[model samples]
Target: MDGSITGHRPRAAAPVGADGLAARRGEAVERAALPAARRPGTAGSESDTPAANALDGMPRQRTARAAAATPTALSAGTVANATAPVPSALSADPAAASGAPAPSAAPARARRPGSPAARAAQAVGRLLPTPFGTPFTFGYALVLTVTSYVAGHADPAVVRALHQASSTDVAHLVRYPVAVLFASALWIVGGILSPYAAGFLLVLTALERRIGGVRAAGVFLLGHVVATLATEVPVGLAVWAGHLPGSSLHRFDYGISFGVAASVGALAGLLSPWLRWPLLALFGSVLAEGLILLDDPMTNWGHLLALALGVATWPLVRRAARARAAAPTAAAA
Candidate 1:
C-alpha cells in the first residue's frame, strides 16, 4: 500500500513539465497584479500582503478626499451666485436692488429780480396796504386831503397857480382832462379846511368795501364827469342865449360832492329797507329845501342828476350778488 501511494505521487509530479511551469508563473504574476479583495476565493481574507493592502486603501483614500472637497466647491459656487449683479429688468428700482434709496430730483430755479412777475408782485404788495385797508378809495381820500391841506395853507400865488392848473372850467376841460379829474377832488371850502375830506372818507371807503375798488372808482368818476358836463353845458347854453354872462364858462366848477351824492344813492339800494328809506328821505328833503330856497339851483340839479345815475347801478350790484351766490356751486362741480 505504501509503494502504491508513492507511485501515484511521482506520476502526478511527472505531468508538471516546462509548459505547466510557465503557466504557473503567469498565474503568479496575475495574482500579484490584482488586489487581494479581487482575488478568487479570497475576498474576505485577513492575512493580506502589504501591496494588496495599499491597493485596496487607494480607492478609500480617493473617495474620502473627494467627499472632503465637495463642501468647499459648493460654497465657492454659492458665493459666486450671491455676488452677481441684478439686471435692470429684474428690479423695478435699480437703487433698491443695490440696497440704497433713490436720489431726490433737483429743485426748480428761482425767478429773476427784474422779471415782470416780480415787478407785478411788488406793485401789488405796495398798493395792498395803502389807506389802512381800503387801498384805492381811502388812498385817494388821503391824497385829496393832503393836496387840499397843502393848497389851503400855501402862499396865495401857489394856491392861484394850483387852481389854474387843476381847474375843471368848461374852457379848460378840453385841454386838461386828467388834471381836472384829479384836481376836482382836492378843493378846500372857505380857503381853510376841506369839508369834503370827511365825506369822501366815509362814503368812498364804505362804497369801495361793498363793491370792489374798480367798481367804486368807476362810479365816482362817472358821477363826477357826468354831473360836471350836465351842469356846465346848460350854463354854456344859457350864456349863449344871453340869459347869463360869459363869465359862467370860466367858473371854478370842481368838488367831490356830486360823486358822494351818487355813491350814497347807489348804496341806498344795497341797504335794508329801514335804512334805505330813511337815507333817501333825508337826502331828498335836503335837496328839495336847497331847490325851494333857490340856494344854488345848478348845484342842487347836479346832485339830483348824480343820484339818479347812482340808483341806476342796482342792476350791476344784483348781477354781482347772483355771481357770488353761484360761485360755491360751480366750484363743487
Candidate 2:
C-alpha cells in the first residue's frame, strides 16, 4: 500500500448509504408511511440516476415530442378538405345489392289457365302420358271401330267396302292399331262390356309399352291365331274324323272378335300377378264368364286357350318386365 504508483492518499470505503444516507433513509420511511408511494424499487433509488429523470419527466417529455413531430398548425381549408363527406358514387348503397327491386321481376308475366296457349300446351301434354297411360290412341280406335260396325251394318255395301279396304290396305299396319280400332267398336256397343273391354285395353297398352310395340303385337297376334285354330281345328277334325254333327267352326263367327278377345285374355293373364287383387278379380271374373256363358262357340275355348297361351308366354313377358325394372335402377345408379 505505501509503494503505490502515484502518491494518492487512501480514502476509507464508505458504508452502503454513504451518499446522503440520512435523507435517503428519511425518504424511504416517508414512502413506506404513504401506501401509494411505497413501491419496492422506488424506495431505494440513487439521487443522480437517469431512471429517476425518466420517471419524473416521462409524460411531459412524450407530449412535447409528439407535438413537435406532428403537423399541429394545419390551414382551415386543409382541415375542411380532410374532414369533408365523400361523393355518392364513392359511398356504398345499401339497397342495390339485395333489397332493391329486381330487374327480372319487373318484366315477368303470370300465366292464366284459360289462355289459348295454355289449352294448346295441355292438349299436347295429354298425348304424352297420363297417370293411367296413353288412352288417346285407344279412344280413337274405339270411335273408328264402333262407327264402322253399327254404320256398316246399316249399309251392307259399306261393310263390304270396309272389309276390302281393311284386308287390302290397312291389314299390313301394326296389329295394335287394328286391335285398338276393334276395341273402340266394342266400346260403343260395350254397355256392361265396358269393364271387360277397359281392362283389356289397359292390359294390352301396358304390355305393349313394356315389351316393344312389335313384340307385343306379335304376342297378341300369336294368341289370337292360336285361339282361332284351337276352335277351328277341333271342329275340322271332328268333321274330318267323322265324330259327329254339322260343321261347328264354320257355324261360329270365327272372325276377329273371338281372336282379339282371346288376345285380351292372354294379356290380362300375363299382367295378373302385378295387379294383385284387382287383376286377380278381373281374371277370375272373365274366366268364369267364358266358362258360364258358353253362348258364343268361340267364347268357351277362346278365353281358356288365351289364358293358357299367356302362361306359356310368361318367359318373354318376365324378361321384358325385368328389363323395364332394371332400366330405372340403372338410371338411378
Candidate 3:
C-alpha cells in the first residue's frame, strides 16, 4: 500500500525563501493601497490619508482632519482646544492682538491748481458776498444806484443827450460799438423805482448763490451783449433795407432791463418744481404782454430775447451749482 501511494514529499513545504518573499510583497501592496482607500469619495473616506502610515513620517494632505478623526485617549476638553479656530484678523496680523491703530485714509485735495474748476472754487469762497451773497450783483447795483442818483439830479437836457449818445442804435454802434454798448447799461430808463431794479435784486441774488458770482456775472453780460446785438442788428438791417426810416437808427434805448430779464430766466431753472413753472409763467407773461402791445418794438423784442438767452444757460448753471455746492466743503476741509 505504501508503494502504491504517490510520495511527492508534500511539495517540499514551498521553499521558505520564496514563501517569505511573497508574504513581504503582499504587505507592501496593502500599505500602498491603504491611503488610496481612505481618500475622498470611497466607503473608507473618513480620513484623506492613512492614519497608520504616520510611522513613515510622510506628509499628509489634511493632517488636522486626519488627527481629529483618529481615536485618542485624551480628554474631550483637550480635543476641543486643539480644534478651536484662530481668528483670521489675528492670524494674519501678529500685532492685531496688541491693539495697534490702523492707518486712516488720506484727505481730499483742497483745490485743483490752475484749472477752471479751481478758479470757480476760489471765486465761491473768496468773492461770495455776505448778507447778500452776491458780490457781482451788489457791486453792479451799487454802481447803478450812484448813476441813477446822478441822472435824477443832472439837467434833463444833458441826461437826454447822454441817453441818445449811449443808445445801442445803428448810428451809435456804427460810430462806437464798445463805448455805447457798455455805457447803455449804466442808466435805468425809469429810475431806481423801475421794475428792473426789484427784479435785478431778487433774481441775481438767488442766481449768484447757485452758480458762483463769476458765472452769474457771465450770464448777465452774455445776455446783455447778445440781446443788444440781436435787437440793434435787426434795426441796422431795416435801415439799410429801407424797411423803416433812417431816423430809426437813433432810437433811445438805454437800460439794464435785458440783463435783468436774463437773470430772471436763469433763476427760474434753479427754483423747486412747484415754484419753477409758476415763476416762468409769471415772468414770461409779463414779457409776452409788452411784446403783444408792440410798444417800443426794439426794447420789447430785446427783453424776450434776453429771457430766451438765459433759458439756454440751464446746463451751464446746473454744473456751476454742483461745483459751488461742493466748494465750501472742500475749502472747509
Off by over 4 Å in 1: 1-133, 188-195, 321-333
**lDDT against the true structure, each candidate:** 0.70, 0.51, 0.78
lDDT of 2: 0.51
For residues 1-333, write the lDDT of model 3, one tens digit per residue.
667776565433444587777885555444443455654423466543445444332333334455345454244777688755444553555544445544456886787569898778976554334445677878988888898888899999998888888888889888889999899989887888888887777788779978978999888888888899999899889889989898988888789989888888887788787998899899889888988998877788888899998889988898889888999899999
Per-residue lDDT of candidate 2, residues 279-304 (tens digit): 54666576768678776544566667
Report the C-alpha lDDT of model 1 over 1-333, residue by residue, as the tens digit: 655555444233345688877886566445444454654335465544566555521222123344345443244556687766555657888786885666777877887569898889976554432465567776776666677677767898987777776667767776776778777766645532544555566667766656667777888877888887788778878988999998877877676778877887877877789998898888878778888899789988988888888889878855664665687799999
State the TM-score for model 1: 0.56
Highest lDDT scorer: 3
What TM-score goes with each of the models?
0.56, 0.44, 0.60
Off by more than 4 A, model 3: 1-132
**lDDT winner between candidates 2 and 3:** 3
lDDT, residue 279, candidate 1? 84
